[model samples]
Target chain A: MLKATVYVTLRESVLDPQGHAIQGALHSLGFDEVKGVRIGKYLEVNVDTTDKAQAEERVREMCEKLLANTVIEDYRFEILEG
Target chain B: MRVAVIQFPGSNADVDMYQAVEDIMGAPVDYVWHSHNDLSAYDIILLPGGFSYGDYLRCGAVARFSPVMEQVIKAAEEGKLILGVCNGFQILTEAGLLPGALLRNASLKFLCKLSELRVVNNSTAFTQDYSQDEVIQIPIAHGEGNYFCDEETLAKLQANNQIVFCYENENPNGSINGIAGIINERGNVLGMMPHPERAVHAWMTSDDGKRMFTSILKTWREKNGVTTNA
Candidate 1:
């Protein structure tokens, strides 16, 4: 089986208000050195396929179709043997 | 006019949409389940607000894949009028029926209050009843009502006059250009953060939203060449 880990984040052009709020909270907590904070999503999927190439292809399709809204977000995934 | 208010699991505003069409506009309306595959019979399709599929993953992410959405897409291609409010707007964006995506409000709060919106384009089927630049009151209730789009899409929208409504007075959710509502290029699909259904009656704060329903019915009647309501 192949375990795919996907990370989705707002595109650089899109504003991240939630991330900005987090940055403010961190600043209040005295994390002065933190210049920025952008929030995102992480997902782990276990693919039953043994073929690494097929697993990668399917996982990419999944991210494009359902896991990510590519209009405002960008997504990348890593596959690992499980 | 025949209207279909799509009801996905977790949709809380379906009844409001039904009542707005049936009671206010005196139109025949029905609740269509998310699993239903056909929408060709309906003249208008209303996707109302709510946490569809618990808003899991992202707002409307899972619900966009519902069986009925395929039919909705087909209906859009056929130039059928579609109005998506709040979470319905989110679903339309996720389904790629509309451009841009809604993000969490800049305040990071679930805002539920009346908002002032200016009618930007009164030529579309959705806003024909309102005069250009007319400010109207509508209630918005959502945490993810912020709208975002790339510069190219924004330019196209402006050039095509697809922007139907803009937030008046103060911007509520930090949407680009204070965009409160927009119509598709074909002018058949409209998605907005505000709830017109909830504001259909005079007793519901302001009845400014009633004109939106009337606009749809008027456009449909004109297109179908029906002078009187049957």
Candidate 2:
């Protein structure tokens, strides 16, 4: 089994409201040095494929088809063989 | 317009959305709790606003792991019309259905007020009822509504005209480029902070918000007709 870890994040231009909230909290807590914040998503998928390339391709398809919305998000994945 | 309004534990606006959808479109609307797994049959799937899961981790963080989200994500992938309002918008971003996270209000307060939004793009299925640059008044109530993004991504969105709605005048939560709502490239998914369902009636100030629903209904009808006729 191949495990694929996908990290999906909003494109640089899309607004990130949650990260701003956290930055506010951090600033309030005296983390004033923090300049900017952005938030995205992390997803893990277990693929049943022996070929690493095939697994990566399938994972990419999954990200494109449903795992990620490519319009506003950019996704990268790492394949782990177990 | 058969719609399914998914309800989570902390979702406070599901019923209001239900009423607006049912009353405005006179369509059968279902209140699908967060635990229900099946959402394949619904024409439209709505994730209503409210403090889901007590805003744990983030506004919509805990709710992102809901059982119903799996189905919602699946439906969204199938090219169904999905709308996320307020907290629902947060959930969509957290679930990777939409872009960017909703942060604290720029004023650092739980803001609740009526705001004007300019429809920047009317080409999408969700905004077909309104002309481009039409300004509509809608209510916004949330603490984490600030939007942020990197410079490059901002330029790309601008180049693609992906920004669907923006603040008319003053920035509400300091969203980058005053973003109020945005749609995916395919135009099948939308995530926005302002509550359109709250403004669908004259009593709610204006029926301007109804335009969104009308647009979706018209698109669904047209698409369905085209499919059946073919």
lDDT of 2 at B224: 83
Would you list the clashing residue pairs of candidate 1?
none
iRMS, all models? 0.7, 6.6
Per-model TM against the reference: 0.98, 0.74
Tens digit per residue, CA lDDT, model 1, A1-82: 8899999999998889988998999999999998999999999999898999999999989999999899989999999998
Q: What is the lDDT of candidate 2?
A: 0.85
User: Could you tell me which 10 consecutive residues in candidate 2 chain B have the lowest summed lDDT?
Assistant: B221-230
Q: Which candidate leads the pack in DockQ? A: 1
User: Could you tell me the lDDT of residue B20 within candidate 1?
Assistant: 88
Cα deviation of A10, candidate 1, in Å: 0.9
lDDT at B153, model 2: 64
Clashing residue pair totals per candidate (backbone < 3 A): 0, 11
**Overall lDDT per candidate, in order of appearance:** 0.93, 0.85
Per-residue lDDT of B1-230 in model 2, one digit per residue for the tens?
A: 57999999989999889988987777799999999999877989999999998986467877888999999999998999999999999889888887666766766788899999999999998899899899999999988887665677667778878889999988978887899988876789899999999999898887788988888888988998744231
Which regions of candidate 2 fall more than 4 Å away from where they truly are?
A: A1-82, B226-230
